[model samples]
Target: MNISKEIVENVSGIDIVEYIIENDNGIAIGIINFGATITKIITPDRYGNLENMVVGFDNKSKYLKNFLHFGSVIGRVAGRVYKGKLTIDDVAYNLDLNLNDTHIHGGENGFHSRVWDTEEIYEEDKVGVKLRYISLDGEEGFPGTVETKVVYSLNNENELEFEVEATTDKTTVVNITNHSYFNLSGNFKENILNHYLKINADRFLPIYKNGDISGKINTVENTVFDFRKGKLIGEDIDKKLEQLTFADGYDHPLLFDDKIGKIELWESNSGRHMEITTNNEAVIFYSGNCFMKKTPFSKKDKNRRIALCLETQNLPIGENEVFKENSILRKNEVYKRTTKYKFSVI
Candidate 1:
């Protein structure tokens, strides 16, 4: 494996560097210092031709206004905090209600919007990029001065892995996850509805219109949320399900039974398959319902389901006590999570 870095551009007086890490197997991963985002992932399709699989912007200026959180890390909290509030240790923390009264993926100045210190690393068999960021105490209403490092690596076996480590000086809440929009068909404008997915989860955490996950564990035995048997993304997407309708499309986090994610996904059009494994408790499934493509930043009029986010993280649900405990990071305690996505052509 080999790694190379180049200054892509400067945004808001901050230098955005792009790192290209390629494995001997011809799989390459591109990451940027801005937001520590994965800008491109080139993998082979069914025809044995390399294609970029992740959705991304073409310039750095678009990242400055990346409200969609494309290929960036969501921090402090992955899901919505009901009414932009959380009571930790009987002390209240008020957050930015970036989305109405509910806070989603941190706030306007979340990790996804900040520039991170980055460096390249190479081991015997792998090459990767490590991005480090520090969140001040009371940053975004969080109660800790947290230091975090996120490493993204690609190996020879077509495996893209992420390892996140963090520590806080004060007791605070923390839940972090990546927000990458993926379209296995290798086209950002193409709908992923035809892709087949199998998630090793029997239940889902439904969210309200405000993006807050209801603590109630709803069984997916017969609902559109069921993916245990492997179904096309479009099979139940429009089945008149309230859960699907509430968010305008698929936008809820499904509680995993055991590990983080035992997800098997594939796009038939390209015959590309990907297996996702993680250590978190749940994975949020979000279809690009808000990518109205009307934004001046978008060159294409990308609409509903143009891309998808399989965000693996610990959800914050008011009704679940265990979930509440999972979000709290005590002083000097370390928070660590790892997720892997392996790709191949079927």
Candidate 2:
């Protein structure tokens, strides 16, 4: 394994450094201290051609204004909070409504926009970076001074792992996940419509018209949401079902079946495949349904379904009492989770 670091840019007198870790097999991943964001993931295709498999910007300005949340660590809470209202230990707090009336992705000043303190990790079989961020009390209207640490490591086995842990000084709610837009075709050569996806989920959380969780969980049986057998993403994406139309595409939290194991994604054209394993109960599958007309990275015209995200995390604490209760992080209690993405050629 090999690792290198360089200063990408300086923002407000703080140096934004990028760390690139490569395995012996030639798979390399680049991450920056800014947002602890992943800038690139280059892997080999069937014919031994190396190409980027994730969506990212090339310059610092685009990353500084990364509204898409591409390749960033999403936190405090991963998904939308209903009406921006969160209550913990009988104390109600109103969070910033950055997305319509809902507080999404920890508000506008959330973890994705923060610069983290970083340290390098050199292991016998892996090379990695450990990033730390301290979210002050009342930042983005969320209580508690949260000290978050995220370690990203790449090993020779073609596995990229994320180890996340956080602690808060006050009672609060927290759900964290990585928002990495993946395209197995490599470098966005084509949209992900042809990708085959299998999610080991028997149920999914529905969303309202405004994209907030509807506080209901429905079985995937006989619905377009069913991916138990694996199918092309474009097969039923445009169906006129209420769930499909509500979010323009797939953007729901899939409840993982306890007996089932990992989620799988594959692209035959490039012969690339990925397996995702997480300790979290839910994974949000977001088809890139909201790409802008002129994105800073894309060379061609706007295309919505260019990539997809498998955001593994605890279910969002919407209006669901059970989920909210489970998402709570009491004072001095630690919140820890791990997710791994293993890549290979099919």
Winner by TM-score: 2
TM-score of candidate 1 relative to the true fold:
0.95
In order, candidate lDDTs are 0.83, 0.89
Per-model TM against the reference: 0.95, 0.97
Q: Tell me the lDDT of model 2 at 121.
A: 96
Lowest-scoring 10 consecutive residues by lDDT in candidate 2?
A: 293-302
Model 1, 1-346: lDDT tens digits are: 9999888788767788889999997888888888888888888898987888887777656877788888899887887777777787888778887987777788989998888998788888789999999999988888889998999998888899999999999888889998888889975436888889899988888776666766777898878888888999888788776777888879877878786569998998888899999998888888777776543234554556777899999877453333677788988789999999999999
Pairs clashing within candidate 2: none
Q: What's the C-alpha lDDT at position 137 in model 1? A: 90
| Model 2 Cα lDDT, one tens digit per residue, 225-251 | 999999999999999989899999999
Model 2 has an lDDT value of 0.89
For candidate 1, which ten residues in a row score worst on lDDT? 293-302
